[model samples]
Target: MSNRWCAVVRCFVVGPIGNKFAPLGDPGRQSYEDSLQVFEEVIQAACQQVGIDPVRADQIAVAGEITEQVFRHLFEDDVVIADVSGGNPNVMYELGLRHATGKLTIQIGEFGQLPFDVNTVRTIQFSRSPRGLIDARNQLERALQAGLLDGQDVLTATRIFQESGEGKAEIDLPLPEPSIEVDGSDDEPGFLDNMIEIENQLALMTDNADGVASSIEVIGAVTESVGAELERAAQSGASNSARLALISKYASEISEPVEMLEKSSADFASNMTSINDGVLSVLGVIQNGDPSELPEGWDGFLDQLIGMAESSREGMEGLNTFGTAAEGLGSLSRQLRGPGRKINNSVGNMRKAIAKIDAWERAARSIKHKAANNPVG
Candidate 1:
């Protein structure tokens, strides 16, 4: 069997730094720390599941003053395990940033502390019990492995958005409909109108689906380009392992948004398939000159189409968020990967590069916003 490299794991604890456990009294503080100790144990369990040495892995605390350092280290590590048990604003902000970067990130929270915004994202929740911690650890480890390996494509795609300076593009949008004219040759009233209506509806649905597919394809392309840039950075020896770690940190940050978009796209496609089938059934009935066969809820079909279009727009918004995070991550990664001494020399160039990316992101957002707000028939 091939030897497995020890995964670099970072733990971001969202709470007040040392000695100020005021929210939780002395007894509660002790209990909280004890819970944290259990959290560490769970992480150890997860490491074992992936055939990695827990002792060999590095674990750093994410204190308030060292947020930037945390970002730098995040890139250096192989995986990140964030503890979101306390209601910590900084932690949540950092977590959102990480998601935007599209890195291998796993979220763990105490049973009741998870933020409402992130409740939709998959997370491992543990109780104060030993068994609960163990179970959470195993689940988180599996998620990490799957995210890192199986999600390589997604990770790479987000990286592209970063490198290309395109901020997250919106995914929810109503597709344009094609207009159809009724031919005078038909011997039926409303038959031609029905045909035109069906065709227009079908055209709109196809266009919407195609738009999502195109966005996904663009994301994939950008990811490939970033990968190439990373290889070049590695070969030039412009950046040491420490700097590389920084790049990895940014990557992890943006990876989450990209992954979310991928999921949204899959869901949209599945829903579209069902919608298409229903539309076809309606069309068949209309063609057979049986307008009465059109179900009473045919109007609902338009609503369904509108819903799909809206979903597509949401997916695009997710992509835009991913893109913004990617830009930050990519710039930081390149800087970290650049030669240590030359870092100062490249500062101006880096700013210009980042500015260009910002412009692209703005353009993408504008287009997505217009599309998303368009009236759906």
Candidate 2:
């Protein structure tokens, strides 16, 4: 081995001695310890064959917690050497992680001790004799040099060396051009996209609801002020023309604001209902675990929802302006319709929409309560 830095090899010496040695009886412990000593000797001999000291090798590392630490090391290390003699769960898990990370890994075991799954992978098998140990060490070193040192990558090596191999490589075929059909109606947004847009608009309404409600308060105040002025004018025997003119001017001034407020309030309420519905739909999907169980594309759906939520914040600000405008319109409309027609038709529409939204909101709350009591996951 020329002192060239090829790759970092993390050697994890896992077996019954390091993990489940104490579980065995007294006689078993002696046998286990003896086998571990032989394994250690073999590892040292293998390291020596490659002109590396087992104690001073920088690339080599060990792991104890196979579930967490071993997998973590597999990602961090370039190569892994797993001792799979004892059929340890931790060792198997670590090996799986190494294989998953697509890293170069070598398996070693005492003769006749390797598990069937591990035996499928080419591994060095050693006997207890001095000559057998030497032979095993030399074989392992040669295998490592070929697979790990000479850049014969693990994925390629695994595919080639494993008996039950992946099929021969197929030539890449060019994808055919998609057939396009011209349809003028297709340019319009789809139902889902429209729903998404509505959801975005609704989010805006919720964020500015307080501001909108405050504007409503202002409209009420303006209406009360105008009402008081009209009452005083009537008592003072003012001309119908002047009284009507004042009322009309006030109504005109506040009509746009009230209309804007009503529209925003309706939109706000609608958006709130839509948001609840969207959340419920997602929760329902999650609860059933049907959509989540999709083969590979489930993450894309989650990402789409997240993207919609993130982009809706800007739209909410526009809804706030709409609320202020609606408030002004409501103030103006109150003057036109006297005490006989107290409520404006636009306000009535808004109130109905708000009521529908409230029903949805309550239903959504109930759904949340039920979901909390009964979690699917």
Per-residue lDDT over 104-170 for candidate 2, one digit per residue giving the tens place of the 0 to 100 score: 6777887887888777677888886888878877887787667655654456434553434332211
Compared with the true structure, model 2 gives a TM-score of 0.35
The C-alpha RMSD of each candidate to the native structure, in angstroms, is 18.5, 27.1
Return the lDDT, model 2, position 74.
55
Candidate number with greatest TM-score: 1
TM values, all candidates? 0.36, 0.35
Off by over 4 Å in 2: 1-9, 18-28, 31-35, 51-67, 152-377
Give lDDT tens digits, candidate 1, residues 1-377: 12264323333333323233547657556655654574457765676566554321122211123444465434434556676666457667666666655666677787987778667667788887778877887787777677657753344445776667552434322222322223334554343455446446545545644544454465456556666766777777766774466456434543443344444444444444444433443333322322243435433433444444334333443344434444444345454332222222222222232222222223333343443444334
Strongest candidate by lDDT: 2
Indicate the residue-level lDDT of 112 in model 2.
Answer: 81
Flag regions of model 1 displaced more than 4 Å.
1-3, 7-24, 27-35, 51-65, 152-377
lDDT of 2: 0.51
Candidate 1, TM-score vs. the true structure?
0.36
Could you tell me how far off, in angstroms, the CA of residue 344 lies in candidate 1 after the best superposition? Answer: 33
